[model samples]
Target: MSVNAQPCPGPQPDALVRVDEGAIWRADGKPFDPLQVAHTRHALSAHPLLQLPRLRRLALSLAGTSHVKYALPNRKAGSAFHTFSESEAKMSIASTFDHIEEAGNWVALYFLEDEPEYGALLRDTLDGMKAQIEPRDPGMHGYSLFMFIASPPTVTPFHIDRENNFNVQVMGRKHLRVWQAHDRVAVPDAAIEDYFVHDTLRSLHYHEELDARALDFDIGPGEGVYIPSTAGHYVTTEEGAWALPGGRVSVSLAMTYFTTQTARRARVHLLNAFLRDRFAAAPMPPGKSGLVDHLKQPLAKILIESRMRLYGQAAPRGMSGH
Candidate 1:
């Protein structure tokens, strides 16, 4: 999709945040509480991604043009729903990635790595996170950052992400229902394999029975929620509630980190998939085999690098992004 690449019309300050084991703190060195977020929406509006000038330009950049995905409103009335045909959904524009919406329940996912300012911002932000996250793994790991902007009352279908995500809410309010990362019932092994290895869509199926076990909460501006890798969750943007005058415009930043532990686990999944699919072997859980884990990690790393090289050669020049 696209946005008006106009100059920023507001201030350009970055958030000063620090993360603890279970909570996030702001500049004052205190837990950043969301109890009063409704009153602070406008005051907490300094996110660089939301700055008009930068946002518009970034939205039109290659990242925005190539990796973008859009969905027309799901007009279904019930709470529990499933995939519907395009005819059952609202009339959508062409599948091309060169469109943008100004109103209605619109949504956009901007590939942040394509924007230079965002690339630098992500590096600096991850640098700040080193003290908090580095203890998990001494070796450096690659990361990705994406920005999401949605209009009011939009419901992102339930899904599981492949990497550890720190979701920062830049504007408006959102209610997120998340399940534990290791909950096999909520997330099946096949689903994980499809995402990490097969490059399928990140979304997962939803079951009404799983709702009772979910930990649901509301988040607002200047606040964020940590979503563990492979955790199942869904997002619902509030409808003009605690948002600006027009339809609620919720802007969020998603930081995804691939630590060593993540890499090892991904290797395990890849190995298990090979054994199961090729050799007809029994399923294997991650972190279960020291020998296999040891051998597969470097192998996985090599395979990943080779694939990247092949993809790089085939991809159009200058299309690479984090």
Candidate 2:
């Protein structure tokens, strides 16, 4: 019901990304082209948000806090996974504000216009809905949604995402040094399966130490980093800050974008929904309707996994390193 958007579609997919740039992030890092990448880092000095400790705290709480996962593209996983040890399928973070509704998966109904967080997130979602250079409705894209999870000290047991994402850090800090995706890594379907079944980090074998596409520095407040769609990456939080007497937390923003393929996928899904309601609904009996699921669920998984392994690592989609 946000006036910001002409109409609302879908539900409960409330935790993937924000669309705009922090001016400085773009100014400093290089990757401006849509196809190529641009990765950058910032120290506490680079961010302005730190001046407001309350907001900083809120951001930290959002990160350290966990949420529910939604149905991710097929990576040989279960129906749904949780966010904190959480859900992955259409993941949702607990929103105190009603606008950021939580139907639990793929259904983040935003209450933007009223709530600041949801509103900010919704606007970001709209920005990424379609490329500014391209001509297409916002609905034309298949997007991803993920809320950054912070684990102090330990290596982020690697994984990939359901869609392309730019994991930008807003507060605290963590290092996720990753390798480009390669076919050489041998990850058993079982390991991916285990991730789904247990909603835990998938087990993978990187014959070599993880690749150093870049050694991700601890992204301090207001700082963010870019990533490719469904690209795999991981992180390790610094010990100093979190180890401080009272300790600080890490909260990063995930910017999920819609790719050409995902846009088409979304379009197909929408058309299927329309047809099902208009033509198929009356004719088909209950429980027999396939609608878009028959195509979407499988395609989602395939695409997610494919993107993750594209550079050739061959590991499960969500585990680190693309």
Candidate 3:
């Protein structure tokens, strides 16, 4: 709780996460696919480093960095993903955490691994699952962490992410609904292509009808869910749960990574979008044609490298030249 807390100490014996044995498989007992929704438990809620005081310090430390985002809470589940701006906050970044319960704020701390202590935590947590996750989706990279702290009655707008996510609930309760990554009805190929090509979420809109098709989870402290790459999902924190003081605060952590398969799919999407625009070619969606995907990977890589050189910018996350 001390504002002068030092950096996270080197690895301690106590584990930050503890996944139950046999908790990573599918309902039919098939081998885990990094793309499927799964449930698991964690010990993070009890970890000293995740206690509010330490987290407050972490939030304070990220005040001026691009790694932190602050926004007013969205109460509507069907709200547009971009309707809320991260830069528009009702409170100062330094004091937001101190008044989290009443601030009605939604704060996200991204890529925490950029901090030394958090990086070690991410590595140790993921290393423990290498045997379970790597066999299914190998060559994992782009390791990142997203910590979300919000006031009650907040909704995380429906959207898709490029990396596979292990969203663990550390405090309060959350009702999460996730549509399958390949469900075209929930998310069309054109929208996905636009996201990969232009980095836009304009095409991803949530409708009430999509809720019936979602895989839902109501999680609390120590509980977590796995969401696949590009899966469309949203979250709503419960109001008046009576778990914490004032029943007004909720916290969760998303541990995400990119795999070899995800990287390949991104390249394929890039090529498909190009073909669709340039030649009016109705290219198949990613993973639909293995041969075509193999052919496009190299071409996409060339294009990405050329663009980076032209603009003097690094390739975006999840689109690294893998």
Give the best candidate by lDDT.
3
The candidate maximizing TM-score is: 3
Which regions in candidate 1 have their CA more than 4 angstroms from the true location?
1-45, 61-64, 75-103, 201-203, 240-247, 288-292, 295-322
Report lDDT (CA) for all predictions: 0.56, 0.38, 0.75
Q: In model 3, what lDDT does residue 56 have?
A: 91
Which 10 successive residues of model 1 have the least lDDT summed?
33-42
Which lDDT tens digits does candidate 2 get at residues 119-225?
A: 46534543543443235223323334444433244344456544445555554555655433222243333333334323354454343344534334444554455
lDDT of 1 by residue, 143-184 (tens): 677776666667877777666677776666667777777777
**What does the lDDT come to for candidate 3?**
0.75
> Over all chains combined, what TM-score does candidate 2 have?
0.45
For residues 1-322, write the lDDT of model 3, one tens digit per residue.
0011111122233454443333223323455677777765655666666767889988887777778776545457667664322355445566777678763567888889889887877777776667778887898788898899887778888899988898877776677888988898998887888898888988887899988888887777667778898899998876755464435778889988888899999888887888899999888888877898888888988878887899876766687746
Task: List candidate 3 stretches off by more than 4 Å.
Answer: 1-31, 83-87, 243-247
Clashing pairs in 3: none
Q: What is the lDDT of residue 106 in candidate 2?
A: 25
